[model samples]
Target chain A: MDINRLERVSDFQWKILPQGKMQVPAIIFASENLIKEMDDKVYEQVTNVAMLPGIVNASYAMPDAHWGYGFPIGGVAAFDPQQGGVISAGGVGFDISCGVRTLHTGLKPEQVIEVQDELANMLYYKIPAGVGSTGLINLNNHEMNEMLTGGARWAVEQGYGLFKDLERIEEQGCIEGAEPDQVSDHAKKRQKHEMGTLGSGNHYLEVQRVVEIFDHEIAQTFGIKLNDIKVSIHCGSRGLGHQIGTEFLKKMLVNAKEYGINLPDRELACAPIHSNLGKNYLGAMRAAINCALANREIVTHLTREAFEQIFPGIELKLLYDVSHNICKPEQHLINGVSQELYVHRKGATRAYGPGHPSLPQDFQNSGQPVLIGGTMDTASYILAGTRESMQLAYGSACHGAGRCMSRRQATRQWQGNKLIQELAHQGIQIRSPSPRGVAEEAPGAYKDVSTVVEAADQAGLARMVAKLEPMICIKG
Target chain B: MPQPRWEHFEHQADIGIRGYGTDPATAFEQAALALTGIVTGLELVKDSEMTEITCEETELELLFVDWLNALIYQMAIKKMLFSRFKINISNGILTALAWGENVDITRHQPAVEIKGATYTELGVFQTENEWVAQCVVDV
Candidate 1:
């Protein structure tokens, strides 16, 4: 809590010196105002993350930093395997690959205004939302395994999407090394019926209209024409990812102890990169990542279906899909040399610069598209990864306007029914089974995403592309 | 008090849920229901089958976590969709038997997945008039 010891390098960057058991210093990127509002525990969580083995550089917290399970939700850190880097479930959070994916509706605002209600209703009916919602695809063990391995590619093969759309997705819609066998049957079961359904609690499908274009040429290239309608889907691997993180963390705790790993925070429980537990977890986690990609892909398919019903000839092309959770192997220039490090982005997203090999050819000049979801009633922004992100935060940026208050606190503070009505009055149609869900996700409960995105852009992590405002939202 | 509706707690990474009843048997059933809500959305399992599972841990806290975790583990590992669970915990021990069946993909009825329970702010104690066990699951 005594963050006074932190050294401020600039208006948005601060560093916590290594002390006690800390293996590395903790770096935080936030405007002075945002830092002032942050919970004292963010400092503790980031420092705890610093103590974990194989941590490279400084443990960095985004402007949206807040206290969370093991790693702060807005925390980003990297570990080197040869240096004994480890993977922690707390680092991934409960919702694995829980990030935002954007789809471009070729229509301008005028096109949607006339049939907005019908479009919203059609989307609401086509895409299942709310707690316990299920999608059209029901797969058995073999099929689920294939989906786990294939991800969006599988969905496309099933005619759920156009193959060209895959190029715009992160990892081309799949993270390799997915082992379905490593994924528990419970995870498959949980995913079987839940495919394509938007699970509730902060998860949402938003139809937005681009209000501002920051970089004209880049925005145009990314198809972010002003007043264009873009649908943003925010969710993740759901129960499957949750299961993987849960099972692995328990095993990792034991593994950590057996390996004589000393953790500053038990929530930062982890396992050595080369260990069986670590390998299995990574495999299963990747499978869950695939599940999430496929889930979003299927959801996009449903969205397109709904849109087609409303506007027969329009095309809803994918803008980009990015995951904020989970760890990945990436090449980064550290200390003047390039090395492969495992980057664990808990509530962080990978913001690869313009020339990364992993990026699609079209985006090579634009950098990867980073989608940040705002509250249902606020504005979401699309940003481009920057070279500064590579130098500052290991190619990581904020995921969204992170929660400032707990769901319980939000529920106690507001009434969901009223919140929904207010949103309706604001020209946003909301759909969910529980009013409590609405209250729990009230915009007031989170930091303004535009502010967070602005901080990120200023801090040299990413560059703004466009700002999107929601017109309709499907919440689970 | 309307059977207390639902009792909830956020134990760091895990969220705990408890449903109450006049009797312990109903309390146990409701507790399972509450646990189901914690990991995955309960509504996903529209139809379930009779399946049983048992697990033991050193402490009741661990027992409870492991108990719920076992059910979730089965759900993930077996692809089974269970709706009923019978649990008994006493003397630093826990015995949980869960019921759910294999999901029929043709039916497209999906179940949510809760990975495991965490010890973060875990509790299972009796209040003056009623028994209470609260814990969080890392879902």
Candidate 2:
């Protein structure tokens, strides 16, 4: 966090030159003020990531970078398998593929306000949330494997959502190379009853209204307009992902020496990409990605059902769903040569630039929609990928307004009940199972999202399109 | 002699749990209690049911993580919140019995679902007469 330790490349770019065991340099994208506010651990973690074997280019930190296990929360790094690249479970994080999805309600804020209270209560009741909550549907062993392999496409087969929704999702709702057999029974059992349920801790479903638009052309492309009501769901693969991460991290740590990995930190445990252990972890981690896709699809279905009950014949169309925690194989130009590399995004979102072949046809000119989640009382932004982002940090951007304070500090500074009352006074209604959960996620606990977004925009990581404010939130 | 107890340390993003006891086994037990305490108050959970868990690792620090992760798995699958723990460590194996009741959302007011324990700041060490076990947990 000390500016003196880093060399300023520009107003929004700071660099840590490679030294000692570092194989590459470390770069952080943030404004001067934001950089000064970052925890010193970000410097340590990002440099530590640069030390990993076969890491390509520099280790990059997004504008919202914060201290996290192993890698910084908003960390991005690419590995070349041919160069002895390794895959790390810590890099992917415990909540595998944890991400955000935004939906268009096609209704104005006035229409939503007419039924806001009822809709809030209905969603809270219909959607399983909070600790110890279970969904109505349970998956047996056979169905569980099917879900793991099929992703949201599996959810559609089970009548959770429409088949057309796949196009808006990453990997068309189901990624390939997932071997269900690689996932342990313990992981599957933990997810059996957790499908369609929102687990607690910084996860939620919120109804928001578009308040500002930064780019009219991109906003129109994303189907955004001032005063339009939108619904966003934030969650991930739940218990299955957690178990897989826990098991694999331990395995990788125990086997690090065998893989010839010199770990600077135990939390950075990794294995060679071509090794059996790495293969097994990739297969299992991909399965968890599908599980997250399926979980979000089911929740989208429940949200649709809740909306239909309140406003008959309303259709909640998918805008875009993006995952922040993942290890994806992508092709990027390294020194003017296109090469395939495994890009690991921890608490960071992929921002594929315009004209990328993988993007949907409609978005070819506009680029991918980058959804940024905010606290219940803060404003969320919708950004578009820029061609510059592909070169900036492997086409990745900040995930959220990263936590600036610890939960314990947040609780001591503000009471949950009082915070809820204050938010209600400002016209934002909240429904949560636990007040303590609400307090820990208080808006004051996070850094200013606008500043972070501004930095990302200035750095060309992504270009902002629209900003939205919460109308009602159902916190998990 | 240090009394068996648990407390939370501050991490930038997640919570760090530390426990202190007269011996390593007791410290491990207290650490598990800290894990449960993250979800809900320990006083709210009842010791109505018991489950046995066992895990082995060559390293004490890894075994400590495995012990807590095993308890996390049990809580998720069994839908239970533990109030008390009994741990016995011999060689590299840890055998333990945890007692608690089924999760009651209304009664417990659980706050967060702990993902798992991480190796960050992980340790099992002795100071004077007290054994300390500590690590940061993903919530």
Candidate 3:
């Protein structure tokens, strides 16, 4: 990116003043080196997002910002309906509600290492993953509509998980305003056999060990300890979300002219929030969000079952579950007055600060747990929302180590078998259906995760709590 | 004349696919090949079964997206991998026949699942004697 085009606000902040058709300024949160390493498209996409209707405050990008389809990944923006605010399908991304969830497996690293190979194999055998993978449970039309509207809460009702797990999840595992009728039958058909399956490309189920603690108090609040075993599942709404996003992006583009909105990029197709098109998209999008929630909940159940097979009667408690790609109606202070705004976070996680009424009672003082995933061989970090983050980027933070190299480049540079062997030598075991998939997800293909987390911490987007390294990975 | 073929381009997070041919229909077919190539090796998939696909759009680029997305929908619902595509576009309506077999995980070693076709870098244009269709696909 061209540093000359931006005004340096701080060591970790850069600003682009509104110009041309831009309705608001563009702000990026990243360290100097991180900002310099960002693709030029990030600048173009962020600035393009600034020109959208009724965008509140400024267009903000997280520390891990990178070039994406429409809005830059790690982009954050809020809009007000009173000002002719618009809702964009591209702003939420194709993988709607794609996020990370961590679980506490009250066991030590040594205990896991004893049966590491067996456990990895069991997890691979039990959890449905990769292309064409289908779960044992198939949803009929009635069940599909119920699952779409009820979310994880419905999963628990179907004997997939415990009711208590809902408290740790965003929106208590079921987001309201999800109109299943708005979702197309074609979308529902795509998801019929896909429930609980981890869709491929950048999705995985990993067993990790906490290696270091950055903030002891916060770590304690999050129930973390050195050598403690944890499992993280990263996926989303699968085919249903993709269908919704694909169908809606085209619709938004066709109706953009009718709404009197000019699109700088066709991918940034949007409609007025108060319009019928926008309302229908929101209803359908929310249904996809619930699908993802239910998907993760069922996977959690499968993970627990796999663990019980190895360590009879072991308990795996839910830590926190939050989606990065979503648009939600949230309340925030604007000009010292609290108002509801529709916030879109594409590849950006919501980091609600301490004392927020939305948080679980246990985390009222410690803030929301912001889970950041890493590459198969890299270290993932646990961060907590900070009060300052609310004022920074609407309490938003980076989701992962944004890819620095393309998949083609990564595959050309590294062999999947060789990469797997290298990771195994480093005490990490990988179970993947395709060696080519492993090559595409090579650790070197992504930016250094720790650097991104450090930038987030320094920028006050989130406070680092603990760091974890992978012990085993079940790649999709 | 250069042979009709497909190639993959580099996008930061996703993959860009471009197809080249003497006409728009062939270019669209090659683009479908590129889309299938993203998931598995094209040669590994066999042309054992055929499915007809139809979609319409007034604009060329959107028609191209609809074409690819229709194939994606077929791949997901049918659990198939397509290696061959025959495209015919007339008056903004695309009617095509795609041939492939059910997904054989062990045989094909599929890499990723393509989510959808996006408008990013989307275009269908003519240059000199050949038509080129290109777009970035989320995988």
Candidate 4:
């Protein structure tokens, strides 16, 4: 982006003063080099978010900010209902509650090297993937309602996972106030067979090995160790979520005018928090969140089954599960007064600091374990939330190395079958539904993850802990 | 008369689909062709089955989003890839027929799955000689 438009706040902080319709300033956290690599659209979209009604503080962009619908992908904004805040479907993104969950594999890389192909193939066979991939667990009408309202807890009750896993997940695996009736039958029908499946495009389940540790103490608290093997699942609510977003965004689009909302960009279609439309969207959005939590939990079950078949007596414990795309009501202090606000994180993770009641009891002394996914070929990182970040970024952190190249461009430059052979040479095994999908997700298509994480740490958005390199990547 | 055509444009993150025709209805049809192009080559998907789609909106732009998303919803629920689209717009309502076959991984070889169409870069207008409809699709 053009540095000329922004004033440098610090080495890692850049600010754009309120202009035109902007109700507040726009701030970005990134290294100078990362900033330069960003598209100018980041400035436009971040400023657009700032212009939204009742946006608290500044419209902040994480280090991995990229141009996305409505708000930028790494955009973080909170709206206060008391201040006539608005709820935007576009801001939450199409993949509702799309997030990452890491599991402790308790095995070494060398141990898996011998059986890597088998493991990858088994996972590919077991985990339903791709555009229309569906799981074997079909949901009846009642079961569908239970899944929507119950979330991962419902899945666990159905023997998909253990009860012990819920505590480590956001909202204890289910967000309250999900109104199953608000979700459309079309959305539900699309999800009936899609439960537990990983949808296509930029989604994956990867086996990774911790290659480096930045903060030993924090890494220890997160149960991460150097050279330790971990499995990370990257996906979302799938067809149901997409249908909800599509339906709601269109609803909000035409209704925005009814609420007297003057949208600078049509994609930023939204309704005031107190509006009936807003309430319905929230109800449905929460249900989608639950669906995602449940889907990931079931996939975790499948992964554990795969692991058990290969390494008997192995345990895959949930380290932490956090959603990057969501809007949740959170309490934070503003000018010495604690107030509840709805925070929207699109391609941004919540990184609550230590001592926050939300953190699991084991992690109270530490912070929320923020899982940052890398591209298929790069090193992902684990970061711990800090009080500084909570205050600075509304408990938000960058989600991943944002895409630097368009999928179309990536496909033009690389071929999927060719790239797979090349990654195999580097000892990274890849399994997917389509080879063309693999080509579109070429590793170089994304920004350098470590650099983004380093910038996030330097900016006090999240403190880096450990780095993970993918040993096997199952793409969808 | 303008020939129906579809092309892809580069958005920073998502793919932009643009279509052109001599008339507004044909432009919408070509837009569907652009949406079809995102997954796989049109030749790979044949017109073996037909699905009907209808959308209603007061404005042209919102109707365009509704039309595409309705097709997306059907595609997901039906698990099909459409190759040919027959669209007609009257007043503000759109009724159409989309034809294609079931997904064959080996034959179709779809590159990526489109989640939904977005209002970003959305346009529906008549030019000096033809009509155009375009929008960005989330994949």
lDDT of 3 by residue, A172-282 (tens): 999999999999999999999999999889999999999999999999999999999999999999999999999999999999999999998999998998999999999
B87 Cα displacement, candidate 2 (Å): 0.6
Model 1 CA lDDT for position A199: 79
Interface root mean square deviation per prediction: 5.8, 0.6, 0.5, 1.1
The stretch of ten residues in a row with the least summed lDDT in candidate 3 chain B is B34-43
Model 4 bad stretches (over 4 Å): none
lDDT of 4 at A275: 93
- Is candidate 3 or 4 superior in lDDT? 3
Tens digit of per-residue lDDT, candidate 3, span B49-111: 999999998899899999999999999999999999899989999999999999988998899
Q: Write the per-residue lDDT of candidate 4 for residues A277-383, one digit (tens) a residue.
A: 99999999999999999999999999999888888889999999999999999998888899888899999999999999988899888889999999888988999
Ranking by lDDT: 3, 2, 4, 1
lDDT of each: 0.78, 0.94, 0.95, 0.92
TM-score of 1: 0.88
Judging by DockQ, tell me the better candidate of 1 and 3: 3
TM-score of each: 0.88, 0.99, 0.99, 0.99
Candidate 4 chain A minimal-lDDT segment of 10 residues: A125-134
Looking only at chain B, model 3 earns a TM-score of 0.98
Between candidates 1 and 2, the one scoring higher on TM-score is: 2
